[model samples]
Target: MPSTPSIPPWDVHRPPPGHGKVFLITGGNAGIGYFIAEQLSAAGATVVLGSRNPAKAEAATASIRARVPGAQVRTVRLDLADLPSLRTAVEPLGAERLDGVIHNAGVALDDPPREETREGHELMFATNHLGHFALTHWLMPLLSAAPAARVVTVGSFAAKTERLDPDDLQSRKEYVPKRAYGRSKLAQMYFGLELDRRLRAAGSAVASVVVHPGGALDSLTPSRPPVHVRTAGARLRGAPAALLVQGKDAGAWPAVRAVLDPDVRGGELWGPRVFGLRGRPRRERVWTHLTDASAATRLWDASRDLTGVDPGRLP
Candidate 1:
């Protein structure tokens, strides 16, 4: 085993021309995802936006076109909640060689006790991990088609404080809004590392990288609370307070860096360098336990069972 290499913060680098690369990003309609797509398109990459809402996706594309004046950006329908939709959503995209795939779609809320998706897995786990798992499994051929392709999965710092309960993955025994979210994020990071290992073992051309945003306050954060209570709470907290929240552009930097940085290696985790909370991107070591071979294998098996998608069958 060798020591992991570290990368400097985002401000240390300049955006290089993307030239003829093709990039795809999930949840590109808003927030961090949209910002990433904007930056990539501005860099000259052919960008494809994947979202559950076609209307919102169209609007996002329009906004990008307005900014870049003929930016090559398009949209595809993808709903992480529905496994069947995942298959249908990506079919029309055609099997073109891809330079990168940014797995950024996610959902978080204080909902009722553990709800399962049509795939029979916890909702958050299904969307945050299994959905991306299935997508990556299907896209391996396209990813491998490129001489050098990268798969960047958006993770979170919360994964550091959470642990996966193999027996209670659905949280049937106990459930908490924050815990569920954290666990799903933990799964995301683990999956990225494991996928990289498998790719290396098979001598594939794809490299897998994981990144976290620290905490970039977004519209999604405010939507967590009930509408009426959320309003009153905002009033008590002081109006316009949330307006000072961290910008999504800063949050998206790490993902962009992981995807496009020439020095980035497989299994490298990128996040803020300051307080691991908010700042520019930097390559940092994930918690030691996250790379534990046993746990990674366990997670890989669980994800395969849950999603019914096996990486071995992929190209």
Candidate 2:
């Protein structure tokens, strides 16, 4: 019998080549998502950028290929805000088994009275949490087929200060934009943790791990040309913030680690190394609020009802 290849020592700068592995990153065309896709592609992974816009996805793919010669990259039209579209989103993946999925896409409405999706769910909650929930369900079979696939959920630091009103998951009664956005991300964290619990109970091969990009600011991010252009003035302006917070590229580390790190287990939360805001990816203690099993279960149930996809109904 042949021994399995041993993983190389972990290096945040130069991750071990993914070779035959395939990874799907939601919103991989921009922000931290683009960096995740770029980094993973640089490491030889076949990266699929899930985006709502085809043209944007193409540009991201081109940028990645330009940066990393011979990079394997592609795009799929994925609109997380539209729940009906999710049911068929994975059909184009065309892989026998999916190695990992980084749930990196999200929406944050700054000034809003509050918005709802066409399905009438709150926009932020629909896109951030429930969309990924349904997509995960659709991707389960492909995920299950892998030797030890990982599902990485990118949460938010904004969630630290907010709590989900389980009864008002949609924020129908009183809708504050920032609070609603935070709550939506908090819901995603809950989904990630709860998914792990169910996966453990089911004896499944896939792992669900949660991660947060701490204080990822655009000004702090280095330029990625057409995708992102950080002017010198922008960099100078960002220098002060850079002391405590990191750029989007650095912000992408936790999720990338969650997906590629062999030792990373289900039910773990990872973030930045320096005060959970900057530097390398480090394992952080899960917040107490996030450990509410009752809330998690309730959110899971509500998500299933809302998304019309039960992740537990694994293929």
Best by lDDT: 2
- Give the alpha carbon lDDT tens digit for every residue of 243-304 in model 2: 89999999999988898888899999999989888989989999999989999999999999
Q: Which candidate is the best by TM-score?
A: 2
Q: How much lDDT does each candidate structure score?
A: 0.81, 0.93
TM-score of each: 0.87, 0.96
Give a tens-digit lDDT track for model 1, residues 80-159.
88876776677777647889999999988677767778767788988998899889887777888898999999998788
| Candidate 2: worst-modelled 10 consecutive residues by lDDT | 7-16
Q: Report the Cα lDDT for candidate 2.
A: 0.93
What TM-score does model 2 achieve against the real structure?
Answer: 0.96
Off by over 4 Å in 2: 1-9
